[model samples]
Target: MNLLDYVLPCLWAFLACVGFGLVFNIQGVGVLICGLGAGLGWLVYLVCVNFLTGDIFSAFVAAMAIGVYSEIMARIRRCPVTGYLQVALLPLVPGAGIYYTMRYCVEGETQLFLSTLLHTFGFAAALSIGAMLTSSVLRALLPKLRLGRE
Candidate 1:
């Protein structure tokens, strides 16, 4: 894969997240934060998928990256992490999987539909679990770190 192969997707993800940020009424730096989070997440996803064996695992890693990023950004900016995290995850969502699954169902391809549906669910679950896991860990650890510093 050439540089453009990665650059283009990250760019698209950034723009898409920026657009969503605008639509969600995020102003100024918040919009930029959302866009950057998405771009970074996509880059992580791409890197993981290139080296990893499964797309689900890749999504999980990417989601964790995004989770860490969004949490840090939230702490720095004093804003809720939900907005940034939600928009950042959009690119990794299994849009194609859902579409293909529905298409197969409509076409009466039982086997294809079932497999696609299950895969889509798995991918979605991985993304959620990855992000949640990171957030939970950080929440559990940050207080301890602060106490240690004090």
Candidate 2:
């Protein structure tokens, strides 16, 4: 509800992305870029969730932010977008949902497991759709944008 609520999560997301960057051998400024992208996504997610109805929608919006951010950063640095996008999105992945769903399944809680698994799938779908939509739109538009600038 307050600043700390948003800041803490964004900070954690940034750190997590930085760790993923390291694991993926992303070095130098790339790591920082990935961390910033994660923080940016989490910040968007927090703001949207506060104002929007569903967390799923929030995740979608956040993924769009990360997608746009990664695309721009890649262009600026003249590098592949894959590493930045993947590392940045690490924080937003539904790891906890998968874990809990599996735990519930193992415990024979069919109802909870089913619900959680469905919700997790929905969230994942939203994330992928958001990122893909952004990337596709940008790919279509960037050429026009460059021509205009020239």
Top-lDDT structure, candidate number:
1
Clashes of 2: 0
TM-score of each: 0.95, 0.95
Q: Which ten residues in a row have the lowest lDDT in candidate 2?
A: 141-150
Clash totals in order: 0, 0
Per-model RMSD to reference: 2.3, 2.1
lDDT of each: 0.92, 0.91
Candidate 1 lands at a TM-score of: 0.95
Q: Give the TM-score comparing model 2 with the true structure, all chains together.
A: 0.95
lDDT of 1 by residue, 1-150 (tens): 999999999999999999999999999989988999999999999988898889999999999999999988888877888898999999998999999999999999999999999999999999999999999998899777773210
Backbone clashes in model 2, listed as residue pairs: none
Which pairs in model 1 have colliding backbones? none
Candidate 1, superposed: residue stretches over 4 Å from native: 147-150
